[model samples]
Target chain A: MASIVWLAPAVTPATEAGDDPLLPPFGAELIVDFDLALSPYSEGSDDQQEVFRAFALGLHAGRRWHRWGVGLAVEGTLWRTLDGRGEDDWFGALHTGLEGSVLSAGGRIRTRVGGGLALLLEGTALDSAGGAGFYVDLRPAGLRWALDDAVVGFDPLTLFMTLPDAGGIPLVDVQYRLCIYAEFGR
Target chain B: MSARTYPLLLAALGLMTLPAAAHGYSLQTAVSDSCHERITVSSLDVLLDLVDDVSGFEVPDDPLLRQLLGRLQFPGTEDASLQVRFVMFSIIIGVRSPDTDGHSTFNLAALRRLHADPAPRGQYAHALRGPGDDGIAGDLAAVDGTIAAILDEVQTGASLSAGGVIADKPAYLDHYGVVDVPVALFAWHVGRALHALQDAHAHMIWDAEVEHIVGVLNYIDAVEGRLEDADGLAHSDALDDCHRDDVAPLVEAATRRTRALTLAIVEAARTRDGAALRAGLAPCVDDATDRDACGWIVYNPPCRAAIRAGDTDAVEAVCCDDANDFCGSPYAAIARQEAVGPYLGCATAPAGQSGGWAWGLGLLGLAWLGRRRRFAAPTALALLALARPAVAAEADEAADAADAPPRLSVVVEGHGSALDDRVDAAILSPAFGYGVRAGWQTGRWRFGLHVDRDYWVSVEYGARVDGGVLDVAAFAEGLFFDDYVRVAFALGTSTLMFDTELHSTGNTGVFSEIRPLGLRFPLGERLWLVLDPFTTTVVMPAIELDDRLPSLRKVQHRTIVGIEGGFL
Candidate 1:
């Protein structure tokens, strides 16, 4: 007497969430992210800080499980960069990817993981401090000689847990982290 | 007989004065109380002797039997002697924290509930209730007369883990019965906890905690008259020799085991060693109320509030102290409030804040006008028929009725590498890898573990430029979402130590995943997106890649930071 249909959620009879074509197409989310990384490279100064900033914009195709759903948006960040010698330096890399989640249950909980080519923009500002730099002087060299790989962790996509406008810096140290996570994909 | 040889000690201690023939009810109370502490291998041996004469049961030999039986040869099982042991175990698993006024109040509440509501309450009792409630029913599946309810809370199955269903399993099955479910589930968890030990990381449970587990299990065997009765299990005839010569000894051994470990637990707890507590009580910390018993019940109003605010100092103040306080035991819900909070940050938002799309859809259906309207009744009925999807989706979210899943899972992932070196002494072609995942699922939540393995392809120390291998990897992640807000936590293993002159050590520096929040409108045919903005954290692992293995060329570690987009 009771039935469970998977496609029944986002569609009237067949369409899924995020698959909708008409509803105001997903808006591009311009993410201006800044990250301060401490290389676990013991051979080098463990305290060596690696600061990076990037802007990417991309939207995803819409999805619908049982009812009417929304599509994903693709966004690319502006000019991504890093901090060298305690000063903000230009990031000679390009980043592009996708993000979205399920529209069921009154809210949306996202699970996002994406990657793209990161090549040096060729010309960038010089590091005034003499601490650490990329492409020309200190760390590594060129776009191919630059840092490349997919870096990932959880990103709060909804307002309930999002940080309030604060960015570029954090409120605490490494000890602030508690959870243990893993990443893998060849 | 083992019992006859130990009568002097039992009698000397006044424990043998009771009529040994009818000690069922009495021994049950005694052993149950005694089981609350740290049990050791040596103490458990003697516990078997105490229960040797009981007639109805026999010792069981499970997959973990030999390991458990090997532990029961010690002495001591008095209630007072084992109290400390039980409390310590309670604390590690988030059950009986010192915060509940120095008592395993949650467990105590369970005892009260068991005593208070002995009658069956149907499946409703298994629903995911809050603290102090025994969501798992007492009647676990019977696999040869042994207690297996412990598996009811497992959340480690494959589908369960991907779906984040392990955390909710135990509470869901509070009404039904799953014989091997609990054991299989806990086994995976304990294995994962143990793996953490090898990684030199801190978690809910550790390897050192083993000394205490064997102790409690030993006590259980001793009190239960474990195995002796098995060989002699010839209730078929009166004087079967297997009953006398074979089974009796096993029974005695099991009884003694229970007594010894109970005493050991008590001793360890008195010393207040963090490791000892971890080993002694991590098992019972399976539920929210169990969190109370484990003494993880954090009552510091300000500390708790600060934890919510993501205050670092407050987290340190409350969690750093590993003594016999409310949060001293790693078992309390409060203990994980910060560091692991996001993963455990469950969502309980109300439905239809803006009213379900059902209303809008409903209005659209009413606007129809046709001659089929002549049979308006049938049209209305058909519209309602189409309403099943909306209603079912809402109902599934609410879980209006009963019954949930009993999940079990096992996983193993590994990676190997190669490297090379040149005249520049620059390393080329290097690699490293490690992966271990396991979980248990029960009801709507899933509890799981993700272990990380590091594989450095090679390390090339060059004169001109210095850069090595790096693997952008994720170590662990916990997520909960199904028509609700989901908290996803990830641990990134970003190692750039093996930086060699070789090809490239994959270091996806940007570790990020999307956590959904707010009401979501269905995205497309098979997807959805949270309607609001969310937050996330990024991390770079502290891996030292200076050491190189014998068989490789250069440091080679290439991997993704984490996965995002679509259902995984």
Candidate 2:
């Protein structure tokens, strides 16, 4: 009887069964993200065919209800190069976004989409020097591997498009990121 | 928001874009580059002429002289004959090194670094004028002393050498401490002394009536919030621009003095006469009679009376007239009355517009909170009360209650970066930091102010980089597993200041720290030992990267261990 009891499946909470395994109901995460540009474009440069790369390190504080989550993230991105030419540029962005798993494969693999307005720091990306600007940062599609305490995700279709001022061309770039997230909370 | 306010808003925005007057000569405006290089090149020409006239002096044969001449002539060129560039570029390194990659490359990174650290006032020959002409005299003496040190080193090197051939011998330590046998050291010191001599001309007003340079604007006094004491003008405040048309006469005088000093140094080296060197420095130093006379013109009773009565024309006629003879008893009396004080150190103020945006955002956050709830009123009051030492002491004592959590807490910790992706281990050692945080705690939330200083040392070049971060943050924490494990999220606005070998640079940015795991152990009634196993800090617009290293990842992870104590 003891052996049978030990072998039998344990009862799982209804919320735990439906929720993403790695993320807590309420948690904070430190995210280290590496981004590779797909369609690199900059309004400041004449060439649009070059590659752009950036590393974004951020902190996300959020709460999750089942498969859907909302969070505020402050990300500092160090761009290796904006126009494939090796010049360093830095930007600090504050983002508010919603993330929800659209498809769940065995509750281990989840397809997610997240997006938000990334408000850029003033005088950072603005052509007029001190002017304020923002970018529409979107994770159109992503795949996440749920672990016991961490979530490793790959965002294949991340897009960043600047909301330009008058007479300014919209700068757009498509990037892919490998995100490592360490989460804590209930 | 109003139509009438649009122009004012636009004007304010334009004013924000206007560049502030820089310290010393404006290096960014290329004024220093142009003026210092021009004066130096012309001085070299004079030295060459003097050398040609001297019988025993061999310009081409003497490796030291030839090297000095060649390096000054073709600086930053491929032909490295002891490559010393312009006085601003080479010798100015002794006063304030330009933010370079240790190489002569001046890029955007170097320019940004310059924005961080301005030249220290009164150093580098930016002397005070008027009643305290002794400052300029002292600065010239220091330059003379440096010249003497160089000559002494040269003589010592000659004595130590086999046949008095000190040239092409390893005599002194270079910036990197590499033992390179070059004639750069002698030229470097000469150029360094000449820098001060030339600045004496640019910094002082060339009094046409007295036919002598007088009235140097005091940068130290100006920066110390003593503008009246500084003669109502700050050093380098739109006044010391070498390219200005009004500054043409001063620049010419600088050029002449520079030539005179250079010629004297060459002559001294040729004849090996210390007296000749002293004679050469005389042209650069302040004249005691002229200085005394000028002091009386500004400080005499009649001039002071006119100044007090707002009779500027009368004061100018009586005190500043060319033929005025107030250089007698009044000069002596005023000199005794207006005795100058000991020189104060450089200003600790940050050079440019930094920390303002962070403070603005913090205030805005408070306002937003106030609008959201009435509870913010007491919080704001508490923050204000914390500024007073006595109130803070009381708050600390009150927070030591055993029944409830502390209302006020303080934490002091020494933290070192456990992981750094940006630093090259071969070049630079890991950075270590110490910080203090103090604030009020209510329930599960803590709001506080923290100040941290991080230091980095270059193992290869022996250069030191110091950084300061001042932050106002709010932390939310939760305890689980019998109150043993704690997790906290900290969000703040951080103003980061960096003092590098080149200059000081700083930026205001938002920073977030997520302590995923922390262990707390009680030590006493009010004290606890807290160990944060994992703390990841991400500062926006990232802290200025070390120029000596290649740019890489910005995130730095630190393990912080500290003692937290609750106070009344």
Candidate 3:
């Protein structure tokens, strides 16, 4: 039985309530975001405040059980500094962790958190600060559109590293990756 | 036996009598009123002397047995004393006969139920019912003879079979009937009977206020034998409000008939006449109305309500309190109301207000359809038309049935920090800057990006020279004990971008930070205030001497407080 609500954008299936345990697995998502960064440690008295424009596309494959799922994601990220400086870079990270669907009906929100490693590749030349870097990722908001099989979401990805010491000025390197993952599994 | 041994025999049988005061209250007083003290004491003396003569056994005599005899003297409860004790004594002796098993006759559970917690409609009540009740005529009819047989067997040293069905192996029989039934066992059983009987005597005084009134009536019964005959105590104005007429007849009938009935059975037992024993015990057979004799016809109102409400724990507690001095369980349902209310959603918004959401959603759905952008108008119009009534009920149902997973939140923080001395001297000025952070929280962990920029300005050769440093780092955080406090470590890259009138350079290097403290405060259902403070270290990459850029490595400290909010 399906009932129409006046303000509802689409008629949701009345059967969705008891069928959550039987929903199909294997899903995908895409996301676009802007990241704001603050570096408190510098060589001198000047504090650093910078915003970066970034986008990421990730492919996820995982198995879903009753209410939750564990999966792996390989993502590509592109970021550019908005400090009026000519600098940009591209990198990739691998993430695997637990993700689960929450809320019922058309308001399904998915969340994921896990740790992995990242590598920086090309773009605006700043310095040779590239390597295999470890990082953690968290996706707080992932929502599926009504009557759609796909999901859209965004996450804040953090990289952890120790660099070779050069000279006097202190540097605080902060990087955030914003990506949308499209699920493709059964 | 010699005359001197007669007194000793009476003492060992626990039937020694003392002088009775007028209007005296106790089992002693009650027994003294109904039976001639010399006759009753001498009767027990003769019975025990015969047991010793026939069985060649010494009657057990100890201070503990004397103390038990004293405790059986229930003060101010005359109605239960003579008749109730006689019936119990007869039953205790009758069980020893080979015709019937003593264990079958002794229903200890039934006895305990009657004595301590009499239920209104049960075998216990029926057994205590005086006469004309089905229970007396049916299940309880054999109890007296059974107990008397048991007592007989105990005195005769008739060994009972061990390890059989419940009726063949009663605990009380084995315990008290051990080794030619000790005199102490008889005393203990008498005490138990007095305990149950005394409660029956005061059954009419259900409320605490009239308890003393019942005691006075019992005292009157002890001295006067019946309340029908007025005494100074009974005629007192203090009892004017008490409808004594209603209760007096019942007590009088039960007491008088039970005493007569008991004496007849004992006399028949003495003569060993099966026919007379059956005829003498006829009055003990209860008719229907006699079931109320146990005085548990009415239940406490709260206890009744709790039972009707299906609160078994409350009912158990309340009923136990009403039946006994110590309530069995102290589970108060009211105490747990608050904690259970939220989980069961006892407080839901009213129907009218909740139904409004449907109309709102319908209008929005219509507007979206009217735009002809995302969805076709025909499908949207159909949805809008059907949604008005359906949405109201369906939305409520969905909300009620939905189960949600843990939510995710984003936190944005900004704070100031100072760079260490290594880079201050190279920059020719002290460097200080502000760092900002943006992160998302998932369950117990937080992941975020942070960046800081430091600026230095100095006068070189009378001209203004300005320099800046920037650092970027990413942190992964974990909370302890699922508490609001979090600690995290960061790793990323930093670039020291410097430019003076003489030279400018961007030296990119490694940077890291340690987040030692993060305190969070929940603002509402989905918002939280977070305070995080940390230290960061920025390492610069190697530079050529020909490059006109300053090299720097430094550590900085910073703190940030912010808010996090999200949706489920």
Best by the TM-score measure? 2
Candidate 3 ranges with C-alpha deviation above 4 Å: A1-52, A82-107, A123-130, A146-181, B1-568
Tens-place lDDT per residue, model 3, A72-186, is: 4455554332221112223232222212232222224344444343433332222223322333443332323322544433222222221111100111123323333343333
The residue-level lDDT of candidate 2 at B332 comes to 19
CAPRI grade, predicted model 2: incorrect
Per-residue CA lDDT of candidate 3, range B1-568, in tens? Answer: 0001123223422111111111101111111221112112323432332232222222224332222223343222234433233322333322221111121112211211222121222212212222222211211222332223323422232221111101111111111111112222322232222222222332222233111111111121111122221211121111111123533433343344334333333343344444433443232223434432222222234544565687777755654221342132221111111111111111222324422333354357446545853332233223323211122224433233223313454665555442122111111222445666666666555677867665543311122323455768787776431233345677887665763222235656677766543544445445556665333344343232432222344444444566666555
Ranking by DockQ: 1, 3, 2
Global Cα RMSD, each model: 30.3, 22.8, 35.0
Docking class of 3: incorrect
Which run of 10 residues does model 1 chain B get worst, by summed lDDT? B211-220
Write model 1 residue lDDT over B508-549, tens digit each, in one string: 332322122223223232233332222222223222242211
**Per-prediction DockQ scores?**
0.03, 0.01, 0.03
Report how closely model 3 matches the true complex, as a DockQ value.
Answer: 0.03
Q: CAPRI verdict on model 1?
A: incorrect
> After best superposition, candidate 3 residue B291: deviation in angstroms?
99
Give the TM-score, chain B only, in order for the candidates.
0.17, 0.38, 0.24
lDDT, residue A169, candidate 2: 16
In model 1, the runs with Cα more than 4 Å from the true position are A1-52, A55-87, A91-186, B1-402, B413-434, B440-449, B458-479, B482-568
